[model samples]
Target chain A: MLSKPNVEVSNKSMLGRLFRKNNKNIIGIFTVVLALLFISPYIYIVLTSIKPSSDAISSSPTFFPRQLSLENYVTMFNQMPIIRYFLNSFTTASISTILAVFLGALAAYGLSRFSSKTGHAFLLLTLCVRMIPMISIAIPMYIIINVMGLIDTRIALIITYTAINVPFSIWLMIGFFNNIPKEFDEAARIDGCNVFSAFIKVILPVSLPGLATAAIFCFMLAWNDFLFALLLTSTNAKTATVGISEFLTAYNLDLGPMTAAAVSFSLPIMVFSILVQRYIVSGMTLGAVKE
Target chain B: MTKESRVSIYFFAPAGIFMLIFLFFPVALLIRDSFFEIDMIGQGRGAFVGLSHYVDAIRSERFIGATTNTIIYVVVAVGFELILGLFFALLLNTAFKGHGIVRTIMLAPLMIAPLVSGLIWRFMLNNQFGIVNKLLYDFNITSSRHAIQWLSDERFSLFSTIIADIWLTTPFMMLVLLAGLQGISPTLYESSQIDGANKIQTFLYVTLPSLFPVMIVAVLIRTVDAARTFDIVWVLTQGGPSNSSEVLSTYMYKTLTRYGQVGESSAMAVMFILLLLAISSYFLFVMFKANKK
Candidate 1:
């Protein structure tokens, strides 16, 4: 009799589960809805980019574009020296990333492996340096650059951005370096590898993900910068970000080209972000938890 | 020192030299310059003004206004982000289908440049043609088609900037919190359930305490970012509708570059650095503690 009751209970639980939706499904629905809401602005921007100038700012904005055209993109290219700005941004970001990661990785290795009193002190100091707002140092930077006669040149931005990005890059790279087993270092030495060669051939290969993360961050810092570019560069070395900001403020209120410019500016980063979402999560939360 | 230990010094030299010459020296120079008044037209420091510029900065009404506005912005923005971020993180902490896609989409806004995000929000919140107002009207949330004056009104401008900041940064909080959430063992939840504890009790006793360290780290990150916010506020409202939204960075920028008051601006920069240092030390402290734990 007892066995029969237990079997009936199991069947009843199965029936209940079949009839009722689970908690996970409800959470999934909410997640989808929330994601849509968060992404709604980009959706609007994409739609606006394709719309005709006249239709973009109409009295009642269309949820979906009725007519699509590439006139804005054409105008963005035709009027602005967009390629020049693009080249400036690319040069600065790429150079900064390469140099910052190279130097930062060196510092990170010492800080991670050696762990000397001075190294930890320097590490703490780097953290403090990263916290100070860019604006706090902008005036001095401007004065320094002007004195050096490096203003209005990509070299000026490249140097300044490299300095700004290195500290945090070192911090990030150190976390990843710490993750790597010390046995590799000892093993490399046993194989007659010097510290530099071992770092090059052994430890660094594993730290590629960390390098990529630091590189992406440095690139974004350079790419997205406006204030330094605004204060430091006049016209010759203006980055794409500075170009877009100025394009907006000019007397001509061309909303369509502006959206087109914004869209183009965001597209590369978005593509890169989606491709490496996992690394970004790890990169951002590094040193936060024990894991 | 041993050869190995001495060789490590070479590795630190390149980064250390760059930071000392470029980053730290400028800041030190800025502090030293605060005592000297600058002749803006001559592009040179003119006279040693002692603490007069510091006194002037303290007495300036604009400085006071910017400080007050910044504090409010940081507190309110961080408050809203944490609440909304925690809520969304919990909602998505499931092994449901489409989770990866949804999570990826949530981080898309973060990849955009801060300045561009400001521009996008600026366009979206336009008084006449904004879709936000249209949606509100369509849903009967607003009584008229006249778009809300997000950027113009002094009362609403600061809040609007906060909303934009929240939109951009909430994903950061969510991602960090979600990582924390996923790290918790499922066995904890099962054991709690078996103990006859209710959902609220489980969350309070098990989930929250476990997540506390991560929460501190997340809040500190947001705090540091929000306290230094410049780009979005500048683009969104230029700290205006009458300086209602002026943060320290924008105010410092205007004082130094536009007004040519270098000495006073340096003093402002000094005070600003102190504030940042105080806040960041706490962040570092907590992070160190968390690591040790």
Candidate 2:
């Protein structure tokens, strides 16, 4: 009688297992549907950008592109200084990233190795700097840029971006540097490699991933910034982001060209982001999470 | 200086100088300008205004409205992002086929510029030619295609920006939370199961506690970030339909740039900074306390 009851319980558990397997599949399908919904905007942009201008704005717009054309891209390039803006963005972002990473690496090394109370305080100061609203400093930055005759100059943007990025880079690199065993530094010292050469030859190569993460973040910030670019630049140094916003102001809003410009502006970074996608999560949460 | 001090100076000085000049100096100027009446046209820091500009800002209806909107935007947007992000993170945490690809695709929005996202959202949320309302109407969720004036109507304008933000940054929250979930030890789940805890009980007792620090940090970062949002709102509605969507950043932008009231704008910016600082410090304090546990 006890054995019979145990067998029945086993049978019931098997049914439960089957039910859960089906339930799991259902949840999987539901999640996939949700993911599609999340990315539909991107799909919409691509489809709309490829469509002819007439189809793009038709009263009865098709979900899919009725016809494909590069006419929008052609118009975007012809009508605007988009290429200049792209080049400007590239110049400022890259230079600032380089400057920020280099300077930040040095400071991070100092902070990591020294272990001084002052270093701790300085690290906290960076946190404070990060918290300060950009608007508060932006007005004065505008006035200073104007006074220095650096307004609408790529150099102005590069310097400003470098300053903004350095603190973040410092915090990120300090984490990486801290992770490196102190014995590595000691080994380098035993080989008669001084601090500078040891840092250059040993520390940096090992920190490549961390450096890349910092550089990527710094570059993204500088590249995607609209406020600084909008306020500081007019014609010569206007970024692609600022350039596209002007498209909206034109008498007849051209969805085709606008979407095309957006695609072009966003494509490079999207690709870059995916290529280095693994580093992003770590970069984002490094300061937050302990190992 | 001592040898250790010298080493510290050598390593840290360049970045320190950079910050002192470009960051600190501008901030100092900002604080100073907040106190003085400045004439943009005359190129003069005209008079010692003391706190009149601050007084004006405190009393100004537009300033007050923008501040309230900013708070609402930060709270609602971040609140929705946290919940949706947690939901998605949990969904993806389960073992499923092609989950990796789905996760990667979900992060696509994170790569796109906020400004571009705004533009894309604007296009998607457009009344007549837009897809959002059309889909709603087709699904019988709304009465007509133009029923929700996302940009033009004052009622939905702020929410429209919030929606775009949720779509844009929810991936970030998901990503961070997923990382947190992965960092959690499987042994905890095993122990909970051995203790006869159900799925919901396991999540509440084990998962939530383990994920607390990550969630706090993520929320703190997102809170500060959402507080200072500028580009999205600017691009989408320009705080339009009678300033319905005017956050502090856009309002400050208008005050300084369009209105040319440098002193008042400076005062407002200073106040905004103080508010952000207060919010961040509280978050930091909470995170610190959580870490102690």
Per-residue error for A232 in candidate 2, Å, reads: 0.4
lDDT of 1: 0.85
Q: What does candidate 1's lDDT look like per residue over A46-145, in tens digits?
A: 8999998778778789879999989889988987898899899899889988999999999889878777465466567666776787888797888889
Task: Point to the candidate with the largest DockQ.
Answer: 1
Interface Cα root-mean-square deviation for all models: 1.4, 1.3
Q: How does chain A of candidate 1 score by TM-score against the true chain A?
A: 0.91
Which clashing pairs does model 1 show?
Answer: none
**Model 2 segments more than 4 A misplaced:** A1-19, A116-119, A250-252
Candidates in order: C-alpha RMSD to true structure: 2.6, 2.8
Clash-forming residue pairs, model 2:
none
User: What level of docking quality does candidate 1 show?
Assistant: medium
Best by lDDT: 2
TM-score for candidate 2, please give it: 0.95
